[model samples]
Target: QVLCGDDRIDAAVTQVISNLSSPFRSGSLLVNKIEAFEGKELKNVADLSAVVVIKSLADTTVRTVRSSRGQSGAEPVAKLVVPALAPTPNYDAALKQLIKVCQEVHVPLISLPGFGDLAQIADEVRFTFLRQLKLNSTRLHTFLMNLVVEEGLEGLVEEVSNQLNRPVSIESAQFSLMASKNMGGTPASQQRSLVDDVHKSVRKQLKVADSNDGKDWIIPTLKVGKRLVAPIMLGENIVGYISSMVRPNDDMEAIAELLRPAALAAMIEFHQNRQTGPMFAATQKSLLRDLLLGGTLAASDQERMEQHYGFDMADGILVFAASALNAQGQPLALDGLPDSFGVMTEIEGTATVVVPYLANSGKTWQQVAEALQKQLKELVKQKPGGADAQIQIGAGRMSETTFDLAESYREARQALIVGSMMHTNKEFTIGYGELGVKRLLYLMIDHPELERFCEEIIEPLESYDEEWESELVPSLRVYLAEGANLNSAARALFIHRHTLRYRLEQIAEILKVDIDSQEVLLNLQIAFQIRDMMSGSTGKRG
Candidate 1:
């Protein structure tokens, strides 16, 4: 009978094998290996089987023997390597060599043919081997069977840590903490956030544990550090990761093997949750699209949104559009948005975040927008490529009720377009109230006639870049914006009035129109708007 209290498997197996009956032993003719550790207990047992070697017992010249013991199992209960029958003079040396070979292969106990009538005791020895195998299997299975009923990710991780006698944690693909074991028990000095720079030090100490590797996992153990991080993969995709704290005396290989089943269980649970989660999110997204595009919400629809999205629209709601682009200005895949007070939906390949607003008693909309801006700044900071991604947030005025959400969405979208054209910096948040004359132009820029008329008026001045490229166009825009005030225009352009006059003359000379003509000024205004619309480049001139 085996008494269990987190005892090592090899130690238990060694104790059981040593207690076998004397009939299996060679009495007075003692084997040096078996008698070597007569008083002390065996610390490790590599193989737990009684290997039998016989000359010409099988039909082959030389054979590594396998019994019926390991047929249904992974490891052999006993392995016997038989050599060619040799002369009596060399028999002792041959036996010694066979014994060394058994030790090397980790076969715990070997039975020799010449040792005290081996045929007479064969049946008894086989019975003992079968008993030992059954006992070991039962002990391991009982422990593992208890782990099968672990309910969720926390339970699974806890069981794995218990089995391996170490701390473990599970993190999502983006390195957000999901569940952890023994984290709370750690002394404050050793505990740190997993995403911080300290994690890099932990990763640096890991070395490949198994050189005969498989593609399924990269199992590494600490060579000098204090933790181990392994991937929890779903097919080729690493859906999550598993990590554990390591002690100086810990067996790295054993710890890695222990986490294998936990990782698989975690993956299965993640897959199931993903499969069920999207069905609910899909319904929410569809309703959100309707609410954003149509300026109407029924009583039932309001209740559904509250129940599913948990947003109270009685206070107010703000609509905002957020888009992410890579450093190269191409759209990047955006995920992991804050979904508490808002629902993110795609409109023309851009993401629209619908924020449910609650008024702070007497706060103005500007104050509210500033608060929202701070929250958005924090949200961006949480993203993986937050710094590299060019994020644009365009918000609409706060609509007092759900009925005005469609108008708010349109305003937000226009803000995204017009604000982007008005500013050079890609990262910005603007509201509809802030848009000036560009807002009206924004509504009309889509017309082919507007584009053509602007192109016709400014094409000469725009095309004549080398002659007076920088000075003329800017001078004309400033002069027109300042209402033909020569001093104001000159001050805005940071040029003398005479120089501004010279540039204005150059502009009129190219366009073949008088600068003071009202029709010409209107055309020039439309031309600048067209240029802004066509280029869609931010950082507009004064």
Candidate 2:
């Protein structure tokens, strides 16, 4: 409609496409390099460079249009073209035809200064197509709206990234990274580093939650490093979050505006899919603490959580605790190894993992530990500056329900503490059952009944040994510890079997109980443990 052809660079590509007759004009230009066709059988039509030459319709003959208004008909063969766009040709079939048709004939496509120079075309194509588009408000809205028709949150996130020419990420309300789109060409490691920084920023904000007494005090938009973040809030609650990299074309202001509607669209999307509650977790930590501390959930919270995390408390469960040591042998917070294995949380300074157990299906704790160690090794390799870090894991006994998991959680943490004390400078997986007498010592060390029972059982033997100057107590201990084996106890005592038998009989007479009875032997075995603990001896390590 302009009196003269508007020669602005923005309209140059359009003007060149417009010069062709109607059908051909609609086709998109394929400015890809020619060398990209290396593997394919190409019709040696033109010696185009390393990139694609022309992607327009036909090859040799083109019906140029001098007729948009009053004129009509072709004006001598000129511009190149591609498969028609109206009906939208099957891409695969259309590409095959284009390759086949190029067997002969060469036609010059539309050319304009600064836009069509041989050197600038490939750069232009890459700059325009490979990068995120600098979209205006209307175009951005249209782009995001169009993507909503596609299924999944991934499509929406990906398209916003594609058109916006930036890194766009979607995270569950708990700030767990969910989906990401990056067109700015950042390396994966750097991206992960950036994500970590963003997570810290968000968590730093969440720390404010505790002080605010759960009131909605989270900042709506958080700018951390080079990323701009916004919550996808549904009134007072947040369902998820959107984050984008800050840049000239897509700065904080633009990203903030984009996230506003994106949040609504995301909420609508989740709503249409009939999801329940916040998308992931606004109370992720609270839920974690309550369950792990005691596995207690209010009926309403439990029902909603059941629908949210889709887990059943009736399932058998095992709890694990993990700690990492840096190269300097200092403790580092565990790096999501527990998380990769199962539902994970941080309690105190240790990483706690609650893995659903399937005992009815013949699953055992050994199998779980083995699988977990294997996964942990793989995940450790991904942590930065942690190549030399050591991971020490401890697991608790298999539990029958989420309620029982509380004990397992405590045991898991205890195992890590006790395992580190017992197995210094080595990696270990110490189950609660593995601690043996040491566990008993730890639990009953301060119990008044423990000391009373130990005194009652052992005082007679001690008095008898002191009076007669006999080794009855040592011999008795060896006998019970050797599981009442005559020869084993004799060898342990370094005495003849008859000598040990005589001493044991004397010990039985002194204590006024048959040493060979199962109940008597059990008490004596526990008595020896008390003796060791009283004598300041932790149980021996193998």
Candidate 3:
């Protein structure tokens, strides 16, 4: 049923097959004609990527080509060709016009010889086309597999580009550029680097490829200006993407065919790497703990740590202490932190995270903190009782060396303590700079003298409030927080200024301390801070 040539013998055989077909027995050997075009003649028979049959005559057309571009506009990567027994009107003139157009576009010429009805054998013809497509797909798989074994991903991608005759790029799950094959000595037209573009695209889209559509891993081709992008998927998840400059009037079917093997290669690589991810992460965590504790490491050990964990002693790093409590008010595990960035470890029940500063990212620490907070917020939403989750993050000052990482960790812990008093809001990041006088007071909170002084200064006031369980302590806190501005304190407490004044006088009378003296006020403030620390309310005093 397949038309191999226009020879008489072949034509006779095609007619014979058409006559014997089931549709012929049903009263007609001629069903419907098919016409297909890419926009021009196919440069090679190998350019055929797939074969699709239009079973319903109503669906038949001269050509069906994808109009949209990029990952969002997914189309078959093949030349659409329809076979017919007879030509339409002006067939000769149309063929000539097609040949002229094919010179400038990818449209294949539509030409057919008038003969006996061939539509009755449409099923056989479509089946043969599919068989050919399968054979070609096998060859593509073989080539990609061989290339991967011989030259790895970079060379494999280059070969794919050569085969598809288009540019191809491979990116990691993080959207970082891994390898790319440039087309015809022309650079990608985007002003930004492809890596930057991919990052921006992923951030904006959240996913570069989506499989929720319940089809193949290929994301619909997304066109950015004159470029095309497709995602490489592992099962249902996207592992990376491939992008290229658009070729004018190019049939994307062939390009999509090439990406199938590329995606397979990417999936293989991703799982292979993931197999060792946990072991590698454990080793990295151990090394980080040792480094932060100032444990001596040999030069080889240091080199190994750097090579495997991507930690460089020369680079600046920051430590973050995230103290999380469950709804039960117990310390949560360090596993609560996101795995996207940083090395997190539990130190005495507190989650300590360390991340190297990305000097090239053009982001400040505050910006990084904001991003982490956002990620954590999203993470919490996925957990049970997330609405009740309480997470407080404290960031240390930037450390220039591993030796200073311990210092940063220590400062971060203290910041968490001091931050609780300075900022009452939970589930946020507070840096060491936000710690003022509490910097020194925080370090001394565990001192017996400090605890004793706090007891002496604030115990009477606290005991008095306990007798009535009143708002005296809250009034004092707000009054101090307002820098002695009575109106501000009264407004904040939702009480009249006279009521606040009366409370202050009563507090002074019971404590037998001067309410107006700056010296007494400072002492009382220090005592209250110490008491909070001792009660395990402000931070981990022990």
Report the C-alpha lDDT of model 2 over 352-411, residue by residue, as the tens digit.
777766547576787787777666666666676567667778898877755676788888
**Model 3 agreement with the true structure over 1-542: per-residue lDDT tens digits:** 32222232111111111221232211111212334322234333212211121222222346656445557767746456784433333333433443454344332222333244446445666566467667876887877777776677788778777777777777654335667887322133341243344334433343433434533323344555555666554333344666666676665544655675666765555545543664334444554655665444556655765655456733578788876556665544446455557766655445678777868888788887777666555666556655566778889999986768778988888787676654444556788987766687777766788867877887777778888877677788778778878999999989999999999999889889898999988886776666664554542121
User: Candidate 1 overall Cα lDDT vs. reference?
Assistant: 0.58
The reply for model 3, stretches above 4 Å from the true place, is: 1-285, 299-315, 336-340, 359-366, 377-387, 416-428, 433-448, 463-471, 537-542
TM-score of 3: 0.42
- Write the residue-wise lDDT of candidate 1 on 50-115 in tens digits: 334332122335666656645577665556676655443324444455455546644533444444
Error of 1 at 315 (Å): 4.4
**Model 1, stretches more than 4 Å misplaced?**
1-286, 295-298, 304-315, 333-343, 359-384, 421-425, 433-448, 468-470, 517-519, 539-542
RMSD of each: 17.3, 22.5, 21.5
Number of clashing residue pairs, candidate 3: 20
Rate residue 291 of model 2 by lDDT. 63
RMSD of 3: 21.5
